[model samples]
Target: MQQRTLDILDKVLYGLIIALFVVIPFSEAGINIFAGLILIVLVATFVITRSVRGLDRGIWQPILALLIAGLLSLFFAADKGRGLHKFLSPLVKYVTVFVAVALTARTDSRRRWLTAIMLVTGLISAGYGIYQYGWLSIRRVYSFSYNPNVVAGYFAVLTALSVGLLTGVKSRLWQFVFSCTTLLGLGATVVTFSRGAIIGLVASGFVLFTMLMSKAKNKKAVLVVSLIICVVLVALTPDMLFQRFRQIADLENSSNRQRILLWQTAWDMFLDSPIVGQGPGGFSAQYEKFRLPGAGDFVSAHSVFLQVLAELGLLGFGACLWLGVLICRVIYAQLSTSDQDLEFGISLGTLLAAVTVLIHGLVDTAFLRTLVGTSMCCLAGLAYSIGLHHKDESSETVSP
Candidate 1:
């Protein structure tokens, strides 16, 4: 009876995880509801089985530190009540989903299912964005989000993941699916006209190509083919997109100037409360006081790292760095392993996905949005699980 109950709970946990991934790209409310349920189910699983085999300390430790830092920063916020709300809703919620998914999606089969879901949903979203841009005469496609930039960042990460999967998987069918997903994701990102997203996608693509070349049997052939593809893609790109890229350096561009002002404001906020900072949601609350003379009214710092530093101070920033370092360490270790199979491809893809978020985050608040942030965290968790599982199997084999 106990064994049966545990099996049932495990099934429930897996179902909830699937549901969470399905709704992630569509609705923030869905994320909240499903994430909450998953957490509850995860806790129940822990209590029933009295086991924490897959939940690694390396994964949770930095997250716990960030949470603690955010909590402490709340005391220094301009509006403590709002800070508390911000801390609980997205900050705490993101952490919960990350840990829960890592624990539940332990096996290769489960992780592959989740990745397929993400690719399908991402493709659908990208298709919708393309339809809006071409048929509906929309200037910028936002997809499911209100802001085009947010959706751009989301698509950019998916693009990197698709590329990673394309190179990693052995199956031709899966490769074709990822190929379509990658192209559509790139198209969706272009329609959004977000320079930051494009820059990030390019950077991550370079990293992916480099990694692939390192593992390829014929390096010269790979390099030549990659160059040819790049040239073809560049030739096919629309003139309008090229113009948008040029605007990144245009001083006359209002958006570019505004972002600079917002970044400056974030710096001012950090200077004011260097220790703990202004707390969660502190940037918007204290924006007026720190706003540059000609800067327009805005909420976010427009940069993830800057916003974290401004809100949670150096301590919170350090915690974030800690988390990033740990994730890189785990993924790198996994990539170093001998097996270059589907799981290896996944680790490579997730690591590049993270690179997209971090690079885009430098120019836009990519990681602050719920969908993008949680999605990246989910991928990170999956990568962590893969690394740990491989290590355990190796240990068992060596012990015998």
Candidate 2:
């Protein structure tokens, strides 16, 4: 009876995870609803099992550090209520989603199912964006998100992940599916006309090709195929979009100037309270005071790293850095030890996804947004779960 109950709860938990991923691109409220349900199920599972046996300590340590820093920064926040709210909703909520999915997805079959769901949902979202661009005559496709840049960043991560899966997976069918996903993702990302996201996609793609080429059997094929794809994507790009790309380095561009101003304001905020900074959500509260003359009002610092430095100070920023380092270590370790199988593909995909978010985050709020942040956390957790599974399998093999 107990086993049956556990099995039922497991199914429910997995169902909620699938729902969360499907809703990510379409609705924010849905994300909250499903994430809340996932947490409830996770808590119930812990109560019934009375064990947190498979949780990875290495990853959780940095996660805990970040939470601690956020909590501590709340004391120094300009508005304690706002700080507390930010801490709990995004910080605590995102961590809950990460740990829940990581703990529940303990099998290869489960991981594959989750990956397929992500691919399908990503395809749907990108397809819609393409429709908006071509049929609806939208200038820049935002899909369901408020900002085109946000969706672009989201698509950029998916594009890199799809490419990684394409290179790493062994099945021709799965490769073809990922190939379609990559093309749609690339198309949607370009239509959004987000310079930061495009730059991130390029950077992450370079990293992905480089890593895959190192272990790839047919190096020339990889290089030739990659170049051909680039050429095709460029040739297919609309003239207006091509002009937008050319404006990235133009200092006279209005958007670029505004971004420069926002970055400066963020730096000033960081320098003001270098230790703990102004606390969670501090950037917005302090923006007016630090805004340069003629600078327009804005909420976010526009860069994840700058925002962290401004809000949490060096302490919080350092905790974030620590978490990033640990994540990279785990992914790299798995890549080094694993064969060119599905697990390797998943790990490679996760690594490039992180790369996309981090690179885009340099000039935009990539990881700070709900959609992108939650998605990245889920992917990271899945990678950690895979690592734990590998460890468990090794232990079972060695045991009598």
Candidate 3:
């Protein structure tokens, strides 16, 4: 009876996760309520069972470390209330979904289904973005997200997922669907005019191509053809897209100058504390004293690494670094041990998506927003969980 109850909870959790993505486009309140419910379920199930089944300790350690670091930083935080409410709390929620999915989606089929759900949801979001561009004639379509850049970041990850689905799934029909979604997703991302997202997508594509061709029979030929195709595509890119790319090198662009000012202010914030820094959620309140004239309104460091260092200080920075290292290690193991073609393709695609986020983070706070961060965290946890299961299975096979 207990086993049956847990099994039912597993399905419930999966459904709720899918619902979270579907509701993301419609309402922030809906997403928040859904996340709150997920947390309640996670806690209640754990308390009732008195056992954390499928905890995936290896993946949990880095998360635990980061949590501890955040908790400790609260003592030195400039605004403990803001830090706890705005920064730390959301992070905790992100981890909750991560751990919940890791524990629940322990099987290959479950993971694949979750990935499929995410891909489909992404396609829906892309459709909305396309509609905004084609029908409404919005200059930079943001869809349901708060801003164009956030939507771009979200689509950047989706573009990678679409590629993963196209390469991993064997069915011709599914592949065709995924391929079309990939094209649409790319179009949506391009229409956002988000330079950071565009660069990140290109970088992720390169990573995916390299991973896919690593063991191919004709690696050199594939590389040559791929380079030629890339060159041709660049030549054929829309003039508006080229104009955006040109802005990357133009400091005279108002946005670029503002970003530089923000960076300078962020550095000043770090210099003030240097240890725990201003603490989580302190940037906005503290940045005013250091703001330069004509810098425009801004609240964040705009770079994930800089934000962590400024808010959490060196300790938080170290914690984030540790998490990054652990994630990469787990992904490497998954790719190395994946015995099936589908598994390899899926793992490779997931890896590239993660790389895209990290690359995008250099220029923008890509993961700070609720929509982008939550989805990325869930995907990371799922990937790590799958890796652990596959590793254990491989060990069992070799033990005999």
**Tens digit of per-residue lDDT, candidate 1, span 1-400:** 8878878887997898899889888998898898888778777777877865566666677888998899889977889988998898778888877787777677789988998888888888889999999999899899988889999988987888888788777888988877888899999999998888888888887987887798899999989998998998899787888998888879779988998999999998999999799999999988888889889989898899899999999999999899889888878788777275667767887888888888899988978888898888888877777877776777889995
Best of the two (2, 3) by TM-score:
2
Question: Model 3 shows how many backbone clashes?
Answer: 0
Better of 1 and 3 by TM-score: 1
In terms of TM-score, how similar is model 3 to the real structure? 0.92
Question: What do the candidate models score in CA lDDT, each in turn?
Answer: 0.85, 0.85, 0.78
Answer with 2 or 3, whichever has the higher lDDT: 2
User: Each model's number of backbone clashes?
Assistant: 0, 0, 0
Residue 397 in candidate 2 has what lDDT?
100
What shift in Å separates residue 375 of candidate 3 from its native position after superposition? 1.5
User: Could you tell me every candidate's TM-score relative to the true structure?
Assistant: 0.94, 0.94, 0.92
| lDDT tens digits by residue: candidate 3, 1-400 | 8888887887788788778767765566776787888888887788769866766566667777777777776778877888887553466777787777777677878777777777777788889998998899998999888699988888888887778767777789978887798888888898898888889988988877877698779999889978996897687566888888888899999988988888888888888877776877778877878788888888888888787777877877887788878876776687767766556656666677788888888989978887777777767777777776765677789996
Worst 10 residues of 3 by lDDT: 340-349
